[model samples]
Target: MSGRFDRRVMVVTGAAQGIGRRVAELAAAEGARLVLVDIADYVQGVAADLRDQGADVLALQADLEAWEGAESVMARAHERFGRIDILINNVGGTIWAQPYEHYTPAQIQKEIQRSLFPTLWCCRAVLPHMVDQQAGVIVNVSSVATRGLMRVPYGAAKGGVNALTVNLAYEYAGQGIRVNATAPGGTEAPPRLTPRNTEAQSEQAQAWYQRLIDQTNAHSFMHRYGTLDEQAAPILFLASDAASYLTGTVLPVAGGDLG
Candidate 1:
């Protein structure tokens, strides 16, 4: 709505729903010509909605968990938009909900593929273009859970994301590409929490899930879930010239949960 990204070329991954979707919409409203990427079929609809709203958008479906997938998305953006000025990496997420001991080797790999590799691959794919142009902004979405209580594997993966944020920021700073991160506190939109096995879940598990959901509302000083708009603000700031002097910082979008 601010038109901060007027006429800019932007890409948002995992943008089919929830935080990712909201972020993409905000960027579009800010006048960005968008490339919405997601592993889900909903990406097409999301892109169509943006297009209907008068945003120049291209929706692409790709499995960002694979190297080829990242490459393909990057290629399509370059082919369609010529250059990418801003990238919002909002794809990473955990899948397995079991205890550390219950995780198999395959599950570990899967977790990394979904929760860590997307950021890494997107970063790798976009850096060359940014470096060549000597201008770009990247906002990677991480989680406060990386620091707060969480399952060990998810925490580890998100910790890697936090590290990647700083490292990429510093690595590209001299090249004129600014990179930062937005770490959200809790659910700000639908698809609210981690996916569950609804069919197999017992009533006790469902009750526990509901309890956690309720607790998330009061987990921060604000006593509420951060809104999609609120969570997207910091990301948009980092993606815009407003944060030109900022790099290597993990800006927490949490309501006073600096942890």
Candidate 2:
């Protein structure tokens, strides 16, 4: 259990699946004590698996988009672990990818809630403990789609995440807290058991989604989607002492497509 994050208490949001789940697994393998958070019940299963492998882990089901939920998660983590060493804000996704005009007011609001508020709320919730300890690391999951996308609302939300990272890093660096972000490119992972959007999509909507996928690949120098590990590695690096000198930087893991 001796590794870069040995004895570190790390909280990873959106830990039910995809890049978030991968981050949890990799971090656990590297000796991090994990607090895995998600709105999905499946997050418990992830924690159980890690525990079976002899990792110290806790899983909490909470809606990170709400301030109360974020507060509860951080409070519980502090109560259990006695310190907040790392926070990876990974809860976000594009629910619907279409032209800006096609998005209704509700849809636009939901997009912002889904892709931005969780990170915002979680950062605010965790900062008090981190600042009190005068030491912590935060790696927010941003997206290259910020510049190339049919999902304008989602892009805007991730843009906010990048801004949050820079400003937070600037504000807290003197206190020994580091804040950074990883803007992942198009990534390949399994289909979600629970899709981000459960509503049926129309043919036009599907076409717009395809355009997003096409443009993502076209804009990448690799001309292909990155693997989940490819995306998670940089996140872990930023969370580890290996990146001790890094702060307030947004590293783009987009195969040369800097967004």
TM-score of each: 0.90, 0.99
| Residues 1-259, model 2: lDDT tens digits | 6588899999999999999999999999889999999999999999999999989998999999899999999999999999999999999999989999889999999999999999999999999999999999999999988898688999999999999999999999999999999999999999997998999888988999999999999889989999999999999999998999999999999999998
List candidate 2 stretches off by more than 4 Å. Answer: none
lDDT of 1 by residue, 88-135 (tens): 999876554544676678777777677888999999998888888899
Off by over 4 Å in 1: 192-199, 203-219
Q: lDDT of each model, Cα atoms only?
A: 0.81, 0.95
Highest TM-score, which number?
A: 2
Error of 2 at 256 (Å): 0.9
Ten residues in sequence with the least summed lDDT for candidate 2: 1-10
